[model samples]
Target: MDKALRGKFGKLLARYRVTKGKGFRLADHDPADTAGLDYSKAEARELLARGTALLAEEQSKLYAQDQWSVLLLLQAMDAAGKDGTIKHVMSGVNPQGCDVFSFKAPHAEELDHDFLWRHVRRLPARGHIGIHNRSWYEEVLVVRVHKEILARQKLPDAVRGKRLFDRRLEDIAAFERYLANQGTAIVKVFLHISRKEQKKRFLERIDHPEKNWKFSSRDVAERGYWEDYMQAYETAIRATAAPHAPWYVVPADNKWFTRLVVAGALLATMGSLDLAFPTLPAEEKAKLAEARAKLVAEKD
Candidate 1:
């Protein structure tokens, strides 16, 4: 049988539960699920490279038309290959039109506003792509995992319990809905790497001189809270997955496979958008033909 088409970004986004006609197939996506795809490592790499080019092409059209935006939100535990995925899958895009942000510990100003405040400032400009290495979802992940961090939100007494957390979910839904209504394509991917895999990757960072800079004591502390973090991810994925903005739990046990999956999912999403380059007017087409004729006349 021919390889199945993953279809377009609009289709996949519509598959999210919150979309008007969305169904259940989009939810409960298994990280290990490969959708019966069969290709060698070489083939997968080539496909990934092609996917990047295709994404860039569509993005270029979107940019020229000044039509839409894509905000790719990557969430994962440390060593889950978020950086690797971004570097490889987005490599073909023009850097000028793409922006990446790493959301770290918040400052005083960030604390003063709502959890999504900092992210609003970093939204992608029209016709550009924004890649968030770690997004506002940390409010759900880190804060939910560590209640002490929740104190920073300064919730009211009655809303201080799980209700407060549910409210954040509602806020996220509203925020994403607003983005979709404003023509933003939201892609949230979770790199699911096992504890053993994370440990191995962490060891590599420690043993390699060049990679040593990536090692931190904080990673150890974070791993210690593995169970809590897993629960946090499960809860966040279950709650925030809307049809307008869906989450894909990409398996990160194999870095190359993870990169391929990220690229494949990206191509699937961008393709779903049904984008195209704007057509030129008749006078402009004639002007371009005349210019090309002049260029050919002057050719060496």
Candidate 2:
């Protein structure tokens, strides 16, 4: 990305980035907000293409450097565009250097371990990027909204009190801090879609034959607890938001804007790492020169 675009994205990111969640209110963020950008859908798509190209370039450097890794946590309500955002924003990235994990309800084995165990096992290796469609935060968000899900975890009575969510948030923050200390950059995004928009999308899924497979009765059931989920999200964001693991409350009503912000957030995160291709040592450089001479000497 050019410096001008980078600057524009930086400013846009600043508007939504929450490093400290004190006094943060989800209601304060307008789901329809586009940061006042009047770009048409085509214009936004072109800009996203540029951003993804730059992201691919940056990912190559990150892989060659083989030092730091990136973990992106995307959390949102049903039909909030998390899947589309990942598909579009990461379109240009090298698949070998990136991994995407979509976390649904826990299975029997997953329930046997602590909340973070399953997620920890799926973490990215060094010099790679891991995208979690819905991550461990679900332990706080979904589990909090639906208390029965927490009961299914079968935790000891001592840890299953009113402060359970708080303890989980603390653990999450500490875990993220540990990852940051170990050369991982964490970017958490909450796709803030309005209830009205969600209803419209749900109806679209019901009406369109191609989208029918995406619809689920469970998704509609969860809609009844919308307010509860919002509160859970707000609390979790407040507790876990930190310098090491910041949250971008991206507006999801507009898919184009959502994709742009997500791309910008990633670009800004990787840009902050100052990633670059590794420099060859003097010995390796000499060996490469010899290999090149041997190859040039051969008649092809």
Candidate 3:
């Protein structure tokens, strides 16, 4: 919340932010990178606590201003810490001012419409922050990785081809730009987790009874297509990264570090919005003064 801490976070955001995707390589980013921060897990936790507190303050202003909204998109492979990041980074925010949506396989009705239909309808209203666990990017990620899924979409013959992914990416970029113009600040994050780290997490889930429910057999099946997913992510990022909808490739091997970066990214985005609590007009101030006088004269 202080100027010094905010500056530190600003620098961290610059390190991972991708506004232009030209020459971007997923391999260029280290999954274990901490941006030279040597803080222990406890130290990181304390920092995150502060960040969340500041975020809550900023969120209050955003809510009261009742104009700008924020959309945070988290995209990653299985076991990449998306859920944990959301839970920890947004802990201090008021639930009424925030909305979280997790997108899985599309339902029959969802598939009936275009890919972005379901997600578009779930967007947050003005004065709220919307978090998407996995979003329309899945059309280019999962659907791209698995061609069979695309066939199930029932697209017209004219729009079904090898170039469809590129076309979809262009549409996504335009959609995000439109949202940005309409007062929604967009921040997209990719939890960059290594294959080794993901495997370890999967094993932990299998071994821990408490985490068993979080484990899905399909998760392991998808692991076999790790490279495919990575390629899809790289392509999507390259196509859609823009000033209005920047992407943060946050490292996920270290959950603490990942959480800190996520918190910082959201903090930076909300901070840039110049959010402030609305000021009362002259008439409203007079009304409030009258109400205060009446309250003072009344019994406790």
**Candidate 2, 33-135: lDDT as tens digits:** 9999999988999999999999999999999999999999999999999999999999999999999999989999999999999999999999999999999
Q: How well is each residue in 1-300 modelled by candidate 1, as lDDT tens digits?
A: 012434422233232223221232323544444445566889877766766777788778768867788899998989888888888888899888899999898988888887898999999998898999999888888888887987776656776775777788778978999999999999888887888888998999999999999989899889989988887777777677767887877767777667766766666666667778789999999999999999999959
lDDT of each model, Cα atoms only? 0.77, 0.94, 0.94
Clashing pairs in 2: none
lDDT of 3 at 82: 93
Off by over 4 Å in 2: none
Could you tell me the TM-score of candidate 2?
0.98
Ranking by lDDT: 2, 3, 1
How does candidate 3 score on lDDT? 0.94
| CA lDDT, candidate 3, residue 280 | 96
Alpha-carbon shift of residue 107 in model 1 (angstroms): 1.0
Residue-level lDDT tens digits of model 3 in 164-195: 99999999999999999999999999999999
